[model samples]
Target: MRLLFHVQHFLGVGHHRRAEALTRALVAAGHTVTVASGGAPVPGEDWGGARVVHLPPARVEAADFRTLRHLDGTPVDDTWREDRKQKLLALFGDVAPDILLLEGFPFARRQLQFELLPLLEAAKAQPRPPLVATSLRDIIVFNKPPKRHEEVLDLVNRFIDLVLIHGDPALVPLERSFATADRIPAAKKAYTGFVAPVPPSTPNRIASVVVSVGGGAVGKALLWTALHSRPFTRFADQPWLLVGGAMMSEAAIAALRDAAPEGMSVERFRPDFRAVLAGADLSISMAGYNTALDILQTGVRSVLIPFAEGGETEQALRAQLFAEAGRAVTVDQAGLTPDLLGASVNRAADLPPVTLDLALDGARRTVEILTAREAAR
Candidate 1:
């Protein structure tokens, strides 16, 4: 089946990463796929042999997401929005896909309604409208206003044909984060395990400590504290590789490299990050969805510090759950201290390697679901 996958990453690239994983899975299964990316182009991302369509990229200037800017530093005006919407409609006409998969729509990305709502409408208007679906993560932001919740329900029930949740219910159920998810029709929701790249079967050649933060734009505090907290931890003597985020400033990343504190090395990003994590003695990182899966796949001893600033609770909840499962140790970002982190590291390293019984084939399963539905058609 031909598939049109629309993805946008305003800040952190986790959304884009997960979307790409699923796209690749679809392509590997012999489906024709096209990825329509609406965010700034990542330097060296691969789409698993699928065709890509780059839309006018708009980036969030800050965490508030109130300021949108083009990559050339121009503010996004109404004219840009209109043009982008027209292009999206044109693409819909061109692809005429059997499956229309939107990443993070009603559950989030409310900011892109100008374009997304029209895209949804176009698909539904087709004489042979595609099977519309949404690709959602395990947890969404918690505690939204009552009216906002109703609005989401209305949109899903109105436009969406399927909701593919990329998580194992054994780890996190949809209702756990957004209680309103329970209201969606049972047949419309499919928990497809966690959408993550399959880990390498090869063993690691080097043993070191891996420290990373997703999207580097908002993880300065975590990386800053980590640079200094190593000495207090049990693996102070082990080599450390600190991965600087792609969005982090050059000067900031350079400063980290300079302040390596003896056995630590700092780099912008690691294409081989998963393989490195597989053989690491310990991992110190934030609790994002992809990273959580990495820790799960590698069974790496880990200390997870969930990003919890500016009313962000997604990571906090994920970290809490991961820690409760004895998969990792949690350190509160609000009250983080070098001494406290060191102690947590010691405790985490002593914990047993992870051995999960839950399904981890979310990407493949997602493709299978779409294939089966298209076949039924």
Candidate 2:
């Protein structure tokens, strides 16, 4: 079957990561999958067996949606959206998907891309092809007011075919924010578990500690603390590994590398992140969904420093949930210093094991669910 996957999240990597895993699973199942994304195209060589199309990237700020400008900061208007919608219809016409899977923003986009629903409706009306489904992570960061929530509910009720929640709903329910959370009708909702790839164990050297700030976008402060703060006051002598995500510029990476402690090593990006993860005795990271899940799935002792900006608290909330469960440690970004980061890392390192065997199977379950839906249709 031909499948189409859509995702747009400018704030974090959660949406992209979930979409990537699902598309990979679909392709592995012998289906042709096309990814229609609004973000800059992922490095083409890296997409691996799926057709990827890029539309202009966009973001919602202060309740107003603006088209992202190129280097000059010029405001490009709604024409970009119109162009993308036309491209999507043409692509769908040419590829003819048997299933259409959308990720996030139905109730969350808050009318930022209200046109997406109409496009979906148009797709459904064409040639009677493809089953429709919407996928979401376990949490939704409610950055707007009650009126936006109402708009979200209205969109979800009218267009979505199925709801695929990536995390266990028992732990985090998406509907609670809506006054009519329980009343909103969905085609079906299932917890597919957390989608994380397992790290291989065969050839890497183990490290005393691993530190990473996801994609290096919003966690610069955490990296600075982890590197500059002395975390080894307890151990007296433990080496640390730092992974600055690709988003960090070379100059920024160089400054961190130059200031590194005698036993510490710093790199811009690690292609084998999971393998690097496997070797760590302890990890220091921001509490992004995929990063947190990966650390938990590895059952590693770690310190999670959540990056809190404005009123968005998704990562902070997620970290708190895990910390309460005795699985990880959380440090607030507000007062978090290198000394505090070190202390938290040490405390987490000393804790007992947190099992993650069940969480690692999220991707397979998601594939099973999507495949079952296709079969039923």
Candidate 3:
């Protein structure tokens, strides 16, 4: 099957990463995949064997997530939106994919409705329309008005053939977050276990503490707090690594480097992040979807401060589930203090290996679902 997948990540790269995992699985299963990305390009993302198409990039600089700009930092207008929409429609015609997989469409990415809604219309108008589906994470940021849910329901019931929920329902079901999820017909919904990459497990482990901020755009508070809390923990004397993403300002990175409390290293990126987490004695970070999945795969002792600003509730819900399962220690992002973070670190360090009874083959399961749907269609 030829699969054309579209994904856009405004703040964190978790959404893109999840799409990457799914496309990789599709490629490995002998299906061709073309990933159309509209978010600002990630420097060294691995997409297995799938081809990539980067649209006119747009990103959110503020936590509000309302203002969007291009990679050149110019504000996006109707012209850019039309250009991107045309590009996506052209790609659809070129690929003529059997499966039109959108990472977040009517369910989220409401800002891009101008582009996606048109693309959806184009796909349906094709000679033989592709199997339209939306690939979503376990949770989403949905504190909007009632009409938001109504719009999603209308689109999904009208166009989408499948709604793949990439999560284990036993941990956090869709209804727990999406109020209108129950209204989606059962045949249109499927839950693939959490999509995660398999990191290399080594013969030995590193004793250092690993702290990472996904995308590093909204993590200055957490990063600085980690530095201040270092001296209060048992691992204070041990080496620590602080990884900020490309989105972090150079000034902030430089300041973090300048203010290092002695045994901590600061950098912009780490290609082997999963491997680093697997070796770390302890890890501290925000509870973004991909980061949380890495902790789950590595079973690293972790203190998760879910990013809760700008009406984002996905990470908070994930942190809560991890706390309930004893997987990690969760902290309040708004009331984050050095002492508070230190205490959670101490508690997480003493817990047993973070074990999960949930299935981690969401990537594979997603591929199966897509192929089955395409065959049946």
Candidate 4:
């Protein structure tokens, strides 16, 4: 089967990592995959075997999203949405994949992806490809009542064949995020277990606790608290590693590097986060979908600080849900303090780790949904 995947999120790497995991799963299950992204491409390497196409980058904060802006505060708009969709259709015409998987924003991107109309039309015209699916994580962060929810719903109603939600319903409720479950006409929604990518190596020895604020775009409060807290060295033997994401300015990185604590190590970024995560005894990080799943997958105890920005508190809610279930600890962004973070980190280290296998079979599950739809056709 041939599959096409799409995802966009600029504040962090959650979208890219999740899409890459899905693409890897599909290709590993013997399907061809291509990723068309509306976000700036990461500098290195192809994801699994999936071919990637870069479109205009999109950024999200809380629940609202828009085209990336220039330093001059101008919103970047290139008539590229249509151009990319046209190129996507041409690529679809070439391989005519068995399925097309849209990652976030098909029923949620608002008016940004107006070009999806043609792509939807092309998929409808195809005789062999019987399924068009949309994949999403457990939670979605939206601030207001969806402004154009019904319009996007119409497109999904008309074209989508399946919805693959990557989360356990027993834990995080999808209804809190996406309220359209009962409205879709011709699609099926399945709650796949949390999809997490496994890191290559499991470290033999554990030393310091690792704290990360994913991509370091937001949630500096968490980092600041974790860094400034004096009790962090209570474990005196256990040190700390802080990862500042690519979005951090050189001056900021230099300042952070300069302000390093006795046992604290600071860096701009690390490509293989799984390894970093796997080696850690404890994690202090923001509660993004991919990062949360990675921490859970590695069975590392964590003190999660969810962003308090405008979005409907998806991460905050997720942390609450997980912490309530004994999965991990939760710290709110507004309430975070050096004392609070340090104490939580120390206590979290003593908590038992829940070792969930990080390998997600999203591709095979996706193939089953797609091929089954085709066979029924």
Task: Give the whole-model CA lDDT for all candidates, comma-separated.
Answer: 0.86, 0.71, 0.86, 0.68
lDDT order of candidates, top first: 1, 3, 2, 4
Off by over 4 Å in 4: 60-64, 67-73, 78-95, 125-130, 142-152, 183-187, 199-201, 204-206, 230-233, 350-360
Give lDDT for model 4: 0.68
For 161-196, candidate 2 gives per-residue lDDT tens digits of 677777765556766333455655655667788777
| TM accuracy, model 3 | 0.95
RMSD of 4: 3.3
Candidate with more favorable, higher TM-score: 2 or 3: 3
Across 1-377, the per-residue lDDT of candidate 4 in tens digits comes to 67777666566667677777677766777778777776665544348867777665556553444544533345655564555667667776766677777776564555456666677788898765447888878887654456566765776678887777788766665677767655665347776667665544655323367777776767555666777874654555566777777666677778777877677778777766667777777788888887787776667778888886644477888888768767788877776778877788777777765654333654456556666765676
lDDT of 3 by residue, 1-377 (tens): 88888889887777877887787788999999999988877767778978999888888765667777876667889888888889988998899988899876787888888888888888889889999999889897787789888988999977899999988998888998898799999999999999977766561344478889998878988999999998888888998989988778899999999999777889898777788888888889999888888888888889999898777888999999998888889998988998889889999999886577787889999988888888887
Poorest 10 consecutive residues of model 4 by lDDT?
Answer: 62-71
Q: Identify the candidate with maximal lDDT.
A: 1
TM-scores of all predicted structures: 0.95, 0.89, 0.95, 0.85
What local lDDT score does residue 372 receive in model 3, on the 0 to 100 scale?
86
Stretches > 4 Å off in candidate 1? 72-75, 205-207
Q: Cα-based RMSD of the predictions, in order?
A: 1.7, 2.8, 1.7, 3.3
Estimate the TM-score for candidate 2.
0.89
Location of the lowest summed lDDT over 10 successive residues in candidate 3: 198-207
